[model samples]
Target: MADPVKHYQSEGHDALSAISQAQRIAFAPMLFQASWCLREIGVLAYLEDRGKEGATTAEIASHCAIGEYGAGVLLDMGLGGGLCHLVGDHYVLGKVGKYLQNDPMTRVNMDFTQHVCYQPLAHLLDAIRAGKPEGLQVFNPEWATIYPHLDALPEPARASWFAFDHFYSDWAFQQAQEHVLGYAPRTLYDVGGNTGKWALSCAARDPELEVTILDLPEQLALAQPRIEAAGMTARVTGHGVNMLDAEGPLPGEADIWWMSQFLDCFSHAQIVVILKRIRQHMKPGARVCILELFWDRQSFEAASFSLNATSLYFTAIANGNSRFYHSKEMYQCLREAGFHVEAEHEIPGPGHTLLVARPLPQPS
Candidate 1:
């Protein structure tokens, strides 16, 4: 194929790097809001607003609502990010504007994450200090509360989360597929896989596989339509269960079990107990994939910061263990539960890692 890429020194990439590095608290809210407009910046909707005619800097500033000085900076920053056109005194959306909407595909997703996920997240420092999220009795409201209202939000809000449908699914499934060393895994189970995104992907790629998702009645009720809408009526299936309830595995069998972004709802002891229960369902060759924001110490990025902060909200409001785990720390927990790592992969983009492990081989 023609060269994979043509440009190396992209200012947009660098600007995002700045966004990824700086903590949410460090930037002025104005800049943060501008950055929030990122998905829309180099998108077609922005171009449409120009009506095929470019405008002066003052006009652009008037449109975006800011002073001339600030607008100049915004234009420069957008240019650095490859989202603006500056030809002499006139400006327009950049060439990149053809692809993304002036608004992001996940605008609604951003609102949900920003409003629901970030508020409690911002309280992490306070939680660490006062040791709680405000005066709320619990720290983790994810499973307990998030489930009931997910469908209540408009489709655009849910759709705002671009990662949930494709990228996130791939990140979690590829970890499992690669961890198995490319073998056609026999049986894989995705617990609480709402919308069956990951399960459907796994089943599609490997025809020999059978996958099931266990989730609450309400989520499953809402998710069935989407699953059918995606035409994954057979490759993937669902079951309703209270994940927190004491229970045993499915009646017949399980060779591999996957929990993507499911463990953050409980305490470590609770997770251990859950794993212990899941262990009994394995057929000697089984492995489990745990996908979440297992924190890394090397460096932090914007997505990572957002993810880590989101988890902190879980810790403060629902369960104390809501903050993301360090890799080594999670491995320790896995070890205590009789699982040793078989493989690990950090998916592309940000704020997610996958750990796949089998029950430690028992010796005779």
Candidate 2:
């Protein structure tokens, strides 16, 4: 097999360029904060409105309701960070600034990073040393993971958290819906059905389909009302049980078992256990479909960079054991759980790959 990481094998930058990159990394937090302030304080918006004409520092300050000194300092960092550029004493929004101001993905990522991941990241080293989400204590001292406390997170954190979560998966769902429903399965089990978003979407598409959401009771509590509101109470149901609990009720028989962006929340061993347990109860010839964004599979360096950085969030704020996986790792997990990939499809737009697998034949 060709090397998956061939591009990252050597130092591609000259010494001066390498040092410049180091400086950028060293000042990343400060620059990020400056960019945030630029957006929140409306400097970016004002500059964007000015277009090519741009605006002087004083004009920007006057419009944004801040002192010229405040505006100058933030705009200075913005220039340093390439969020804006000055031409003839006028500041114009740069391409980076435009994306920061306008891109939905960028907006969701920034909000999530600022509101949910920032404070927790301070304890990243401690979490690494302890092999636990030590930073999660910032939200609740008693909680071991952030999943259960998701709904109760304060203010913008809750909103940003869900926005970031749904932004990636929801878009992919639009493309994945057709392929999954194409199986023509009468019953589908949505394992780790966070908020029943996938289950409801599928249920809405196929009138004959009956969907079951398997997830934590806390998540189930949140999903049940949505199902009721959608008037899917009769065909959709919640199975509130932790997959990690070995003694928990096995998933009921289903023609299709779907796990979308779910197994990444678990360690390799945990994933094997969960899949093995599902294998025990899945009906004969039932198929398992997994939707994931493998870091190594991304065509763009930026997308891969995003996925790799997201792994740190898993370590510091999530379960502390799981991360965005490479395709090989997931394939190994499937093999260990007695399945083989029968087909793979790349969903258009968001770079999500869906794997369809069936159980290996059992010994007599």
Candidate 3:
């Protein structure tokens, strides 16, 4: 079946539109910084507060306490970027400007770019050339991947990383709980369960349910106090191990394996290995639920843009070999792991798709 939502046209552009797009790409860095400063320094918010009548540059400068020269340049750049509108001497928030101030996704993306991906992205060319996560050198010289050092990342970077992760996955948790709990699975495995958000939620929701989170030791350490604080220490536990370590095996006690925003952290080959390992350990009748933002499955072009851009972040910082896989690629991995997708669901949020798979019955 063809995907009606997936369409990318390859067409020639006229001279003016071509040049306009080229200029947008060329000045994107400057515009991004300008937008960030405007948001951080209160220019965007001030204009938003001023409403449709907007505010003059003098008023903005006075309110923000920046010099008129500084305010004017940012505001002008905002106009060029369609982030603000200049009518007469007043500056009003454009559609883009409003979202910049009020959108949670925008805020998370900005902070993540600034604190986590910004410096690392400078080494993206090196990473691509070497086919490795060379950009992670920004954080630590010894670490081969970002997962192990997540807890140890510097203040704003660590905060920003979690914020970015949660911003995309958190909204889907409620729907996820409903979907999984409907099956009445007594035991759940939370793979790559950072900080135990899902574990904490599921355990609290079902008195009979127990959750085991499998992640690196550092991440488990961070989740420990939180689980204890939630008074779910008995029901929710952390298993400290690297899922990518082929020699190590997953616990087979889980009635359901839940991986949310997890599988994309590994390459296609690694995804197969991880899935195969899980299949080996899954209890009879157990199911694996995978939640991801598959680029080819996105409903909108903007969502696709975000996921595609995130694939680069994975290459440059998180790990060198993974990507935001297409849905077909994910399905292929499931089949290779000896599981068949029994159901597919669209989580009630942006860019999330869930695949529920069951193990292929063993031959007699």
| Best candidate, TM-score | 2
Q: Clash pairs of candidate 3?
A: none
lDDT (0 to 1) per candidate: 0.60, 0.91, 0.89
Model 3, 121-154: lDDT tens digits are 9999999998789999999988888987898899
Per-candidate TM equals 0.66, 0.97, 0.96
Q: After superposition, how far is residue 196 of candidate 2 from its true place, in Å?
A: 1.0
Model 1, C-alpha of 284: deviation from truth (Å) = 2.1
The digit string of per-residue lDDT tens for model 1 on 1-364 reads 1221222225454777777656444654544355446443432354457755766667766665656776667666556545566777776677554333433334433554554444455555665676444413222333334444556544544454334434444544665556543645676777777767777777777777777778877767766887788777776778777666657445336566878777766667767777766765677667787776655521344444545645655655444455566567677778877888887766654446667788886667
Query: What residue runs in model 1 are displaced by over 4 Å at the alpha carbon?
Result: 1-27, 34-57, 61-115, 118-144, 154-157, 161-166, 171-181, 230-235, 247-252, 297-306, 313-320, 346-352, 361-364
- Name the weakest run of 10 consecutive residues (lDDT summed) in model 1: 1-10
Deviation of model 1 at 65, angstroms:
8.9
Q: What number of clashing residue pairs does each candidate have, in the order they appear?
A: 17, 0, 0
TM-score of 2: 0.97
Off by over 4 Å in 2: 1-4
